[model samples]
Target chain A: MKKSIAIDMDGVIADVDQHFLNLYHSEYGVLFTKDDIAGKTEETLFPEAGAARKFAFTPGFFLTAPVMEGAVEAVKKLMETYEVYIVSAAMEFPLSLTEKHEWLRLNFPFISWRNIVFCGDKSIINTDYMIDDHLKNLDNFKGKTLMFHSFHNVNYNHHQRVNNWDEVIKLLVEEA
Target chain B: MKKSIAIDMDGVIADVDQHFLNLYHSEYGVLFTKDDIAGKTEETLFPEAGAARKFAFTPGFFLTAPVMEGAVEAVKKLMETYEVYIVSAAMEFPLSLTEKHEWLRLNFPFISWRNIVFCGDKSIINTDYMIDDHLKNLDNFKGKTLMFHSFHNVNYNHHQRVNNWDEVIKLLVEEA
Candidate 1:
């Protein structure tokens, strides 16, 4: 109960590929769609532009999206015990933090927003548990790391992989 | 089925107030716990610190946070018909979109990093549906908007709210 939980946005929250697909669609008449890219690499979605290859650290692409199912409730439940923070790497985008904060307020105003941190190295921060969608961060994260399940990310096999916050809370509670 | 889904972090991902409570306990010697604020408001969490005031938006707070319940599967299921994207907004925090992409890759690599969007205005984007916790963006979204439920934001009674994305997809699929 003394541990804290850190979560990631993007794939975990609303939809993940719609933005780029939306953009790609508007630019080119690409018909690959999400399904064509599922179980494949980013290049599958953007074949000619190599856009997926360059997206390793793109900006103005991952803020103020949607919340995953039970994301609000799970955070609510965990907040009951552990300290929660949103250490994100969303700066790679071109928007400012103020713009990002507005999205959170409009979407999840319930969060204190004070305890949030958008750092480059999330592992550098101090916390008890880490729930993210990236293997690099999760692999390096100290304490309990919960790997959020996504379609494109198929290599993660180490930590506990879950699809929702309820499972995340269950794992943390069980550990507690 | 080529469409994608997107979600928000913060209240939609995990219980934000509880995280604050954990930090509050460690910082100001405050003993306010989850039950104390469950279904309550900022007024109860921080009575002396302008409890009546609504929670402010923070940047890094939501960067690395937990995913909500059923959010993963809902996104996964929705991916069956749409390319899921994570579109979020940042305030002043220093988050890296690269790290966010890596995080998503490590967890749900199945989702292309290109799918994530750290943007400012969501209405400008196009999608079949959006599952957000806020109400303002949904005010005039061109696509179908599914409002996520939040205890802190119970005053919203004007929009079409859904308990989860499953219901949202259900409605969309039925209409289609």
Candidate 2:
């Protein structure tokens, strides 16, 4: 039987950091490099409180976010080795649900709609392995977890870390 | 710790058959009674091929679905006895994602966004019990399953069947 793996959307495959940076530049008229967020949380990326959530709730926020570098190729490769499911904690921002679905359809066209999930919590998820940026999601999953490295989650070290999709491919595919 | 229960949205709580009947009436100048779909699948509710799917894909189809009779009261009562989560397999119809979220917010206002789940498959769900109309969903659930009554699922008998919201309250709430 093929092993099932759950993959997170935002920081892992969607490159939410780049999205935040772009949105911040467009909203504030000031461009900031990745260094601005080094070892800092996502919330701090915006000067004002709740700006991260405000952007998340925006109509086109999730739809227009750039995909992570090497994500499409790496995920397609991972699909050949295991059952890949895109799991996003998206019910919090109701607007993001459809946008995320459409975004995935546009970017990861090979992934079937049957393998996509949008939920409020991740503890309900059951899979053989999970790749996510948040510890909240990884901690509850009763399976192998690969923590995708992000500025916000740099302090978290309970799970094996993958810095990028190439690292993901090396650990789950090339090394398999 | 409270035991969690996953509840299906469409045929289980949303009265989708009634919505279809109403749409068929408006679309074709003739009212469709419940007897019209007795022992028939949801796909055959409309005379034309794919009409049911067309209605489902329509923008307001999910948002306008009426809550099943007594569902609010019964579900609220159940919530007092168990942790309730609304789980809908909605990824196949991307448009339904946001609509379902809005529908739940309007009808089941007490349900937190943190407890709503929109997903493609029920097999990934881990809950103590599940109440759903489709066998495809209930069959994959690892815990206790309550089969909500629907014309399309009348013949399925693998799980405990609850004919209505009152029956659901009786079985899960009063019995508890």
- In model 2, the Cα lDDT at residue B160 comes to 96
TM-score of chain B of 1: 0.69
lDDT of 1 by residue, A97-135 (tens): 444555556666766655554444443434677777778
lDDT of each: 0.59, 0.88
User: What is the Cα-based lDDT of residue B163 in candidate 1?
Assistant: 65
Model 1 DockQ class: incorrect
- Give the local distance difference test score of model 1: 0.59
The residue-by-residue lDDT of candidate 1 on B1-176, one tens digit each, is: 47645565545544455556655665568787545665655565576665323223333434344455666666676677776666554322334333344445554556654456544444433455667776765775667777776655566767777765567657756565
RMSD of each: 20.9, 1.7
